[model samples]
Structures are given as structure tokens and as C-alpha cells.
Target: FEYAHETPKRNKRKNYLTITTGAPTKRSYLCVQSILYFLLLLNSVIAIIMWATNWYQLIIYKVQVLSNNSLNVELWKNPTWQPLLSIYIFNYTNVDRILEYSEKPNVKEIGPYVFREKANKVNVTFYQNGTVSYQVRRNYTFLPEKTRGSLNDIIYTPNVVLLSAAQMIKEKPWFVRKTLGALISATKVSAFNNFTVNDFIMGPEDWFSKIGLNLKRALGEDVPSKFGLLTKRMGLSGNFTMNTGKYNTDLVGQFEYIDGRPGLGKWEDEECDK
Candidate 1:
């Protein structure tokens, strides 16, 4: 009988074992894929929740200049017109906290306090290149939800307003000038609320903390360029005194102070100051 070499049963058995072990490996791979899918789903759910709750908080303060006398936009933009001021106002400040972090500044993001336009807030009038009068009708500071106010609440109109001074000066009609020259600015502001700049802070991370939070230490109430300092530099000190009121705690309160004119007649004439 021709002895044909029979294939070894042991080798054949070993190959079968190897093929069978692959089933567990396949199961493990499927488990890993399932875990990855679950993680992705969890991430998606968290993103949706964040979008609905905390992403839409924003406050906008609209600036409007209205006068009894018609203002020529073209004329106001004249080269001779002085650049009065770029009113940099904010609702609050946390410079003391920001200063703590220089390199590895551990920072935390706070809130979305919103300002709503409302009536009976603050109104200032101007005329003859001077502030004729102003009124703090109602306290403007409020929590975001409290911003339900009329159109007149947020619009600012002034008569005899002095925008800035480089050296010069507008010619309005007599009636227009007179109307704008009135000492009292008319608005829907309320008299019941007379809060100052300091009354509205609920907490360090509240609404006021979120609006116009200035980090610049050199500006605002701490600086020499404030109303009092600038006047003092011009040798016009002792001319007037200002009585400070409380600030709005709801939104951040910016320039809000009452100055008592001690007979401004002592101010140097235009030619003399020049």
C-alpha cells in the first residue's frame, strides 16, 4: 500500500482553535464601537441644554442725540466742530479681580445682565454749548427681566448741550435755540426711583458684573480726566461741587453724578482761556 502522508490531526486541530478565538475579538470590537456612540450622544445632549439657557444674554445701550433745534448731521460733522466725547460707559467694574491674574490668570465667566429701554430713567438737556439742565427721572438699573419700558425710556435728548471743546462753536433758529435752551429736559422718567451707581450690585457675578465691565484701571471714577479733575487742571477748581448719588445695581451704571454749580460766572472768558 502506498503510504501517502496523512495530514497531522494536531495541526488541523490547532488551526481550528485559532479561527474560533476570533469570535471574542470581534465581540470586543463591537463593544468599543458602542461605547464611542454613547459618548457622542451624551455630548450632543449637553450642547443643546447650554444653548437654551446661557447663550443669549446680551445688553445694548443705544445712543441718540435729539435737540429742539434741528441738527444738521452735515454741520455737526464739520471739521471745526469739537470732538466732544466718545462716551465710554459701562454698568460695572471688576478690575480688582482681573488684576489678580497676570500670567496664569484663573478666570471665570460670569453672567448676561441685559439693559431694557424704559421710561423715567435719566434725561439731560443742552443749549448754547452748555448743559442747560438734566433730570434723573427714575432709577434705570434693573435686572434683565425688568427691562420692559417704553421707547422714551432709553432715548436721550438734551438742549444747550456742549459736546466737546477744541476752541469753538452752531447757529440754530431763535425758537429752536430757546426750546433746546430750556433748563428742564422733558421725558417719561419717573421720580419714585432715585438709585445711585452703587445700589444695584447683587453680587460679584450678578447682572451689573456682566455689563460693560471695564478692566482698564486708568479710566473712569479713578482717573484724573473725570469731570472734576479736568476742570481743576484748567484753574477752574472751586467753581462747582458735585453731589454723588447711588448707582444702579441692576445694569452697570456709568457716568451718573449731580454737579452743583457754584455760580459758573467766574469761569474765564473764551478769549482769556485761549
Candidate 2:
């Protein structure tokens, strides 16, 4: 009876095939896990790249200058856009009537003589404390096309030097006034002078200025050599000390000192000086 029960042999090949089929499901699950991990790694790399790009943009925004080492220094040294000066002169229309008939002076306003001005920083000295000291030199060039009147046009203007001198010495001693009158008579200086617009604004040293300047010097008065509308301001500006915007961006071009003084002492109040 035992020999009959053991007669049926098990199918070993069928069992092996079933085991191999089950192994394929496990392999598929592992492949899916690997795919998920690769997707996660790709997403993380993209996020990191975006963050770095944002950081680089922030750096650029913080330093909005031409050079990384210097903070808006080049632009401060030389401005791209130059300012323009427009001058208007009063033309004496009825000088003869006013002088001969004692009539009120008739004046007519003329022009818009335009000039382009260029200011350059000179004698620049940079300090280690993020400050810069320099002087500004201003140059003006006449813009013929922009001017309303021709420079060669004759203009009748009052003798500014003579009038100013008369007013200054009016309160002085009689001897001083008599001396100035004699000087004016000797020079044959008139009450008004006829000059070209160009000469009046920027001169070849008019006769009145020369004689007036000499008289002023004889009186021991300090005065400028030339007298014109814009001639006095054509030179270098006073010494200026300013922040270079290195430490604080808001302090660029702010004044620290004018000439050698921290503030102008001409005012009565100390706060007004600043």
C-alpha cells in the first residue's frame, strides 16, 4: 500500500516555473522605486539652480554700478548730461530820451543766449575712509543754434562798474567822492556803453572794467580782475569733500566740506551755515 501512494511524482519543473514568475513582480517594484528616486533627484537639482539664479540677481541689484570695485565712481567723476545756462539781458531802448528829456528809462528784455556747460572733477584724491576730495572745473560753450539772438548784435547797457562804484562811495568822505569823480572824468567813462552781446556776457576786457578795476585797486579794495555775466564763475570750484558711496549708497555726492570749512560761516546762525 505504501509503494502505491509514492508512485505519483511531484512536478519539479512546474514548481520552478512558478517561482521564476513571482520574481518578475519584485523586479518591477524595484524598477518603479528607482524611477521615483531619479525624479526626486531631478526636481531637487532644478530647485537648487533656481535658488542660485535668484541669489545672483540679488547681488546685481545691490551693486548697480559700472564696476564692481567702484560704486558709481565713474558717473560721478564725469556726468553724461551737461547742464545748460540761459541768459536774458535788459536792452535800454530809450537811452537818448531818458538822458536828454529826463524821461523814465525804457527797457526791453532780450534773449535766451543758451550755453552748454560741462563740469569735470579735477585734483581728485581718494581716501581710505570711503571719502573723495576734488575740485570742479566748469566750462561753457555757446550754442549758436539754440540762442534766440545773435552774439554780434549790439546791446545798450548801463555802466555796471561805474554805478556800483558810485553807490559804494556815496557814503564815504567827500574827498573820496571827489577823487572818484575826477578819475571818471579823466577816463571819459559814460553812463551807458554800447557792446556786442558776446562782449557784454563774456568780454575782451571792456574799458570800463579796466579803469574801474584800477580805481578799486587804488582804493585798496579786493575785487575780481574780469567782470562779465558768467566770467567769474568760469573757473574751478572750491575744494569739496564728499562720500564715495562705498559704505552707504545714499551718501554719494553729498557734501562733507566746502573749501576747507565744514560749513559756510557767512550765515548768522550755525545751523544755517550747514
Candidate 3:
């Protein structure tokens, strides 16, 4: 029994290997941070490309001038000079950038643009029926040549009204129909941006449409729509401009007036505004 107990000897030791999680966790965290940096870079690039390029703003003024044969508007008659304004939208560059963009020249413009007026609509009878003659004329051009202001090429065409025939005014007398009163006016026009959301990729119109896309698309040329009555109204008129949807303006002068001209008084009296 003693010999048998001694023969059955064996070593029993517990050997163990441990795997730590810290290294794997650190690797995974680094990978996530790398992805985040890449995503941020891409987002910044997209934002830069979508920056605004061509910019335009328009201001419209409506003036209803009350005039009879005695005091017709005389401002338009002096051809020696003309009242006008001009804005040049470049081919993505301007006078300063001309050096940078010398090779690519695209000067777009809102030309020697100004409130040009139609000829006076006069039914003057100097001798009270000496010659019962009435004359009316209306024409519109985006920019006229040699006007007062920097002149540019006539790039845009306005809605022009050409009177083709005698307007059958009234049955009783020509004088009765013509004496109602005359209105002087200006305008703002509307049209769908050339692109939809589908084409918003780079269309300036699409960017502008952002002002009121749904309303503008539905209205589709709100100002032009009302143009039907412009040519046949109380007096002559001219046209074009802007994306701001506008409505008919109330008469300011006859009822109340705003001396639109600065440093000027009543245009009727040419006296300083008091």
C-alpha cells in the first residue's frame, strides 16, 4: 500500500491567458474620429459651391399725375438731356475684378435704365375748338441710347404698346372722354425662375425663387398679367423689372403726396419742399 501511493504522483498547475479590451476599444475610437473628420470636410465643400453669384434688386415707383391740357408734364420734352440710371451686372466679375477675369468678359446690365416716359397725351385746343386734335403715344425700351446716365447696349425688350387705330373714345364728344385725368406710372414684373427645385442646381432664378417659390410659380408673371390694361388706360405708360410680387399702388399725389424727389418741393411749383 505504501509503494502504490508513491507511484501515482503528478503536478496539477492552473495556467491562464487574458485578452484586454482597452486596445481594441482604442482602435475603434480612432476609426470613428477619422470618419467624422472626412465627413466634415465634404460638408464644407458643398456649402462653398452653393454661394450666390449673380445678384439683382429692383425698385418700382408708381406716380399718378393729375394733368389737364393747361399743365401737361413738360419734363419729357427736353431731348438735350434725359433722366436715367444704369447698373452693370458682370460676367461674374466687375471693374476691379476685370484684371482677374480679363479673359472672361460678360457684362450684363440693367442699362441706362430709368423712368423714360411716353410722349405727352395732349388734347389741347388753344382757341377752344380751333383744331379738335388729340395725340397719344406710348413706347418702352429697356434702355435708350444717349440718355442722361451711363449708356449701355439695349439688352432687354419691354412690353411695348403700339396704338394701331383710332380709339373710339365716346359717343358724345372727344373732349368729354379725354378729360377724365391722366395717371403716370412705373412697374415691377414677375416671372417663374428659369429653374424649378429640380433645376435649382445653379440657376440664379431658382435661388431668387426662394423669396416665394410657390406663389411666384403659381402667379407666373404677376405684373405682366396686369399689363393688358396698361396701354389703354387714362394715359400712356412703359414697363418691366423685379421678382417681388406686387399689386396696384394707390394714388399718392392727388389724395396725398410724397415728394419722391429729394431736395425738391412741389414739382408743380418748383419750390423747395417745406
Candidate 4:
């Protein structure tokens, strides 16, 4: 018998095409990680560059003081503001009553004489050791609008010259004091004098001041030729040396020396001299 082999029909291959979103594969994840790392590195590099650039600019503008530093130097050398100066005077109305009648002196407040002070840094000299020396010249201009009283207003007050002269000789020998007292008595100078505000503040070019100046000169005292409340300080002050902030910003404008002296020697006390 010829039996035919049974032929099993092959099942039709089912081709079901389904598409769905899912997490990235390992290769794609690694690529994304590399891109993120590249971006982070770029940001870090940019930040470092910006920090360095800002530091350099700050050093150049703020810290370093050189001839080429135009902005700082210009502002320092020539200031635009005019500062105000106020003066108050006390007038003794009852000097004679206090001296002769033994009564309390009547005191009166005179004024608030305002003035516009102009300052200039003259003779600015720079040294190689990062130091600068300069002299400040000051001038006062009366501002009548801001003043409570006139400069020509006359008022009576104690004689400052006479008192100062007496104080100077008080500690000296008794003979010296007596001789000076005789000289002062002969001049007919009283304990009080009438002076204008201008004369008192600027300086009184009167007979008393002239006589006092002459006597002090004769006595070999180191006193100013002209005596006034603010006369001697009206002109240029002494020379001052300061750091330039070239190497150290903290030391900028710090006084290295004043009038070539490291410390002031005008006071009697050692601590006060500095």
C-alpha cells in the first residue's frame, strides 16, 4: 500500500507590528550623559574665565594707583565740592563790671559766620617707592547768605594777645613777669578790645598785635608774626606723604610722614605729640 505522508500545514506567521514609547537604551543613555558632562565642563570653564577677568579689572581700577590711572587720580587731585566753615564768637559785654565792680561778666553769642572753603592739592610729587607727597592749599570765601551776622560787625571781647602773653610769662621768673607787666602797662592796653569779625578771625593789624609781635620777637619766642583765630591756618598746610596703593590697597592715603616728620612734636605730652 502506497501511503502518502501527511502534510501538516505550516501555521501562518502572524506579523503583529506594535509601536510603544519606553526608557532609553543603554547606548542612548550613555550619549546623553556625555553631552550633559560636556555642557557642565563648558559652564565651569566660562565661570572661571569670568571670575579671572573680573578680578583683573578690579585690581586695575580700584587697587592699583599709577600715573595711568586717570579716573582715580583726577578725582583725587581736583575735587569739585567747596566745603563750608562756620565760626562762632563770644562777646563779653561787661568786662569793666567784672574787673572793677567784681560782677559776673555778661556773655553774648555773636554769630555763625559761614564761609566757603576751597581746597587744592598743590605740589603733588610721586616717588618710586609707591608714595606721594603733597601740600594742601586752602582759601576761605565769605558766604553772606549763610552767615547770621556781617563780617564788619564790631564786638567787644577779651584781649587774646594780652592774655596769651601773660600766660607765656606766668611760669617764667618773677622778674621777667614784672618787667613784661610794666611794659604791658606802659602800652595802655586794656583787658578788652573791640574788633570786627573779619579782623578777629582773619587777623587784627592793629597796634597791639604789632607790639605783641615785636615783643615776642625780641623775647626770642617762636610765635607767629600775625595772631588770629584762623589766620595762620588759612594758607597751605605742611607737606604730607601717603601711600599710593600700588601694592597694598589697605594702605592707600595712609600718612607715611607729615612735614618730613614721622610724628608731630608740637605737644608737650609724649602721647599727644603723635
Find the candidate with the highest TM-score and give its number.
Answer: 4
lDDT for each residue of candidate 2 in 172-263, tens digit (9 for 90 to 100)? 89999998899889888879888899988886477668877777777787666677787767878778888766666677667788987888
lDDT of 1: 0.31
| Superposed model 2: Cα runs more than 4 Å off | 1-69, 170-175, 214-223, 245-250
Per-model CA lDDT versus the true structure: 0.31, 0.81, 0.32, 0.83
Worst ten in a row by lDDT for model 2: 14-23
Candidate structures ordered by TM-score, highest first: 4, 2, 3, 1
Query: Between the candidate structures 2 and 3, which one is better when assessed by TM-score?
Result: 2
User: Taking the tens digit of each residue's C-alpha lDDT, what string does model 3 give over 144-226?
Assistant: 45443343232222111111011322343555344311210122222111221112211223222333333233435233212
Please report how far candidate 1 places residue 111 from its true position, in Å. Answer: 2.0
Candidate 4: list runs displaced more than 4 Å. Answer: 1-70, 217-223, 266-273
Candidate 4 lDDT, 1-274, residue by residue in tens: 8979988999998879878789878999899999999999999999998879978877675635644354567667778988898999998888878879989888999789998888888899888788999998888999999999899999888888898889878778899889888988788888888889889888899988888878778778866667887877788788999888777777777788899987787887866775
TM-score of each: 0.18, 0.69, 0.20, 0.76
Most accurate candidate by lDDT:
4
Residue 119's lDDT in candidate 4: 83
What number of clashing residue pairs does each candidate have, in the order they appear? Answer: 26, 0, 2, 0
